[model samples]
Target chain A: MAVVVQFAIGLVFGLGLVIAGMSNPAKVLNFLDIGAIRSGGWDPSLAFVLAGAIAVTFIGFRLVLRAAQPVFGESFHLPGKTGIDARIVIGPAIFGVGWGLAGFCPGPAFTALATGGGAALMFVVAMMAGMGAARWLANRRA
Target chain B: MRRSLCALAGAAGPDSVNTEFTPFASFLGGALIGAAAVMLMATMGRIAGVSGIAVRLLPPYAGGDVAGRLAFILGLVAAPVVVMMVTGSAPDLHIEAGPALLVVAGLLVGFGAVWGNGCTSGHGVCGLSRLSPRSLVATGVFMATAIATVYLTRHLM
Candidate 1:
């Protein structure tokens, strides 16, 4: 039952990504291209997407977290590390460089895998390889 | 009056600026995504962070609901198919990166997202929603860098 629910949620999330135009590299690049504001070609649709998602989530988390426990889980498994750290900043900074280059973040990249043609396939594969390498390095350190 | 107002808004003509601004669609989609995150939290007590979820599915697997995570990803892959059935076509997606760039970008995205412990969905949406300071910092840094990168690549390069 929980799996079913997760599958449904994933479907909704992916559809949202598609409808929001995050799956389109051109649209994403336009948003990232802040200089386009001068040329009158800047697209601010991505900001709206973030605003809308965050608004709903903020309200939703407030209400949902109040419950004793989730409907299906034994306990809520939130992130453990709380303090700001170099890893948090440096890691996302690296991710940002990649995102700007291709406009393919993790969610949209995966969501685009099926229909985004061969380029999408190449990106996903390379992404998986990168993920594997990161995991290996982390394990070695720990 | 409307013409002047439009000019003030920098929208004097459809071609002038923001020709692709679909505020309504974007907002609706975002709401749906938020709803999905809420549902995941409500039902399973999991954060709907795509990078976190995807990384767990890789080798040296983390302990948790592996099957559930797989189902979620499979559903994501199937979403376009559903859209095609309902709307008679898949959503449009254009890849500006060639194979080499795609690979490089993919590596950075995969590694960075995992190392950082989140991505846009995780940090930008879920983390901000929870009002985590770490998330706020992470989001700010990434957004700034991403903007800078675009400017450098598209403008300076």
Candidate 2:
């Protein structure tokens, strides 16, 4: 039952990515291309996407978190760390470079795998490799 | 700064921005995504962070609900098909980066997202919704850097 719910949620998430035009790298690039604001080529669609998503999630979280525990789980698996650290800053900075370079964030990239052609496949594979490397390094440090 | 002024002056025209703007679709899609995140949290008590979920499925495997995670990913991959069925066409998708650039970008995205502990979904949506200060910082840094990168690539380069 839990797995089924997860799958359904994933499907909704993916469909959202598709409908939001996030699966399109060109569209994402247009949004990222702040320089184009001068020439009037900038796309503000992504901003709306972010705004809409955050609004819903904010309200939804407030409502759902009121309960003692989740419907299926004993305890919520929320992030506990609160400190602002170098890792948080440096890591996202690096990710931003990659995202701006290719316009493929994880969620959109995964959804794009269905019809995004060969480049999507290559990107996903390389991303997996990078994830593996990160995991390895973290384990070594631990 | 001068260019920003020009943009403001020209903002009245429909063609002033990218013509493909779909504010309605994007917002609806975003709402759906948010709903999904809420559902996941309400039901399973998990954060719907894609990078975190995907990384756990990798080797040197971190133990958790492996099957559930895989099912979620599989569902994501299947989304386009559903779109096709409903819309009578596949969703528009185009990758601008070349193979080499994509490989490099992919590695950076994977490593950075994993190292950072979240991506847009995790940090941008879930984190921000929870009003997490760490996420606010992360989102700000990444958005600034990403904008700079795009400027460098599209203009300076």
Candidate 3:
């Protein structure tokens, strides 16, 4: 049941990417070109995808939170935070640059694999390794 | 209700910044994702931080946290379907590589999500906004590797 939901979610997210036209590498690559945004000639179509994703999720969260225990468990578990720092700004700027260039982030890339392809596969693998290395280091240091 | 409201608003023309996540849309798509992440955390006590949930799937996360994780994941997957059903027309899509490369990319990303403590979505959107030191480092690594990978593949020998 849980896995099914996960798959469903991934599928929808991918579908959203498809609908928003985010599945295209060229579009994403174009987004990365800050000069485009600066030139005021930027194609803001990707923004629509972002808006749709955010809107749908925002609405969904409202319902999900109303539940004491999401159909799967008890109470919400959020990461702790006190104030904004370098991580907040620097992290996004980095992400924006990559996202702007590659045109595909991790989620849609892997999900695209379900339908089948190479670029998605490459992205998924490298993304995993990055995550693994981060975890190992965090644990070791802890 | 909300959908209709959005429709009414979107009808405002091209200046709105659709953020539709499609090459055909605008920065509004990114903004939407960002806003969604913020609203999600504020409402659900969870950061729409996907990388974090994916990480919890490993050995160390064998506890009950999986349920919420499952739900968050589910919502993401469901959104697209709902969109297609409602919109009638689906957006365009294309991948640059073949199957073999896509698989390798998937695994590498999975590894990074764990090591980075969160993927860009989790850290970049949620963690970074909240000022998490860990998210900062993870985001840095995400970019460095991506640039290096793209550079090596797209240019240098």
Candidate 4:
């Protein structure tokens, strides 16, 4: 059941990327490439993605909170931490730069594999290595 | 939007989905993901973490969580098929980069997920929904890094 839900989430997420224009390298470039923020040249379409995502989530959370127990298991598994730190700041910074540059994140990359697309597979491979490096950094504390 | 460009250029990065969508469309799509995450967790007692199940793709995953993993994966695969049916034609596949950079990009993403402990959907959607500090921070980092990388690669590099 959890697996089913997970995939459903991934599917929705991927489809959203497809729909929101986040999956597009050019659009994403427009979002990140702000120096030359042209009217239509510098597109902030992601704001729409953010807005839509938040709206649905806000309503969804209310509904989830009303439930006694989860459908597939027992309770909702939410994050526990609350403070800002080095890892948080640095890890995502690197990840973001990569995303903006590459225009691909893990979820979309995996979905792209289904299409046998070239960029998708390349990102997937690079993503694996990047993850490996991160693990090393985290474990090594270096 | 051209296939050869993604295959031939240096711009294609695995985010090919972005190639086909508009800002409004992706926003709606994200909501669906967010909704699915909320509903699945509320009713299914799960957290919609992709990496957890992906780990199962490794070993000793045969029976431990195979059924659920397959189901989840199948659901994702089925969606595009369904969308294709409804839309009449599927989105075209396109990337703006060559194979070398694509591989490098993928490695970075995978590494980032491992290091950050989750991906955009897991942290951005699910984590942010719970108001997790880590998720918020992670999301912040993800966006910031993306902006910086673009600067370095496109201009500085």
Q: Largest DockQ belongs to which candidate?
A: 2
Model with the higher DockQ, candidate 1 or 3: 1
The TM-score measured for candidate 3 stands at 0.58
i-RMS values of the candidates, in order?
Answer: 2.7, 2.6, 7.0, 3.2
Could you tell which candidate, 1 or 4, scores higher by TM-score?
Answer: 1
lDDT tens digits, residue span B1-157, model 4: 3323543444433323222226657667667667666666676566666654454454445326577666665565555556677888665445654577666666666666766767776777777766787888888888877887765554444
> Which one wins by lDDT: 2 or 4?
2
Q: Rate the local accuracy (lDDT) of all candidates.
A: 0.85, 0.86, 0.51, 0.63
TM-scores of all candidate predictions against the true structure: 0.92, 0.92, 0.58, 0.79
Task: Tell me how far the alpha carbon of residue B75 in candidate 1 is from the true structure, in angstroms, after superposition.
Answer: 1.4
Q: Write the per-residue lDDT of candidate 3 for residues A39-97, one digit (tens) a residue.
A: 45344564455445545554555555666754443457666654555444444444433
Q: Where is model 1 chain B poorest over a 10-residue stretch in terms of lDDT?
A: B10-19
Which parts of model 2 have CA positions greater than 4 angstroms off?
Answer: B1-19
**In candidate 1 chain A, what residue range of length 10 has the lowest lDDT sum?**
A32-41
The ten-residue window of minimal lDDT in model 4 chain B covers B12-21
lDDT of 2 by residue, B1-157 (tens): 4434533443211112244889999999999999999999999888999999999998655858898999889889989989999889998876657788789899999988988889899999999999999899889888888888877666554
Tens-place lDDT per residue, model 1, B6-65, is 335432111121348789999988998999999899998989999889999986569678
Q: DockQ of candidate 3?
A: 0.22
Measured against the true chain A, the candidates' chain A TM-scores are 0.95, 0.96, 0.77, 0.83
lDDT of 1: 0.85
Q: Which stretches of candidate 1 lie over 4 Å from their true place?
A: B1-19
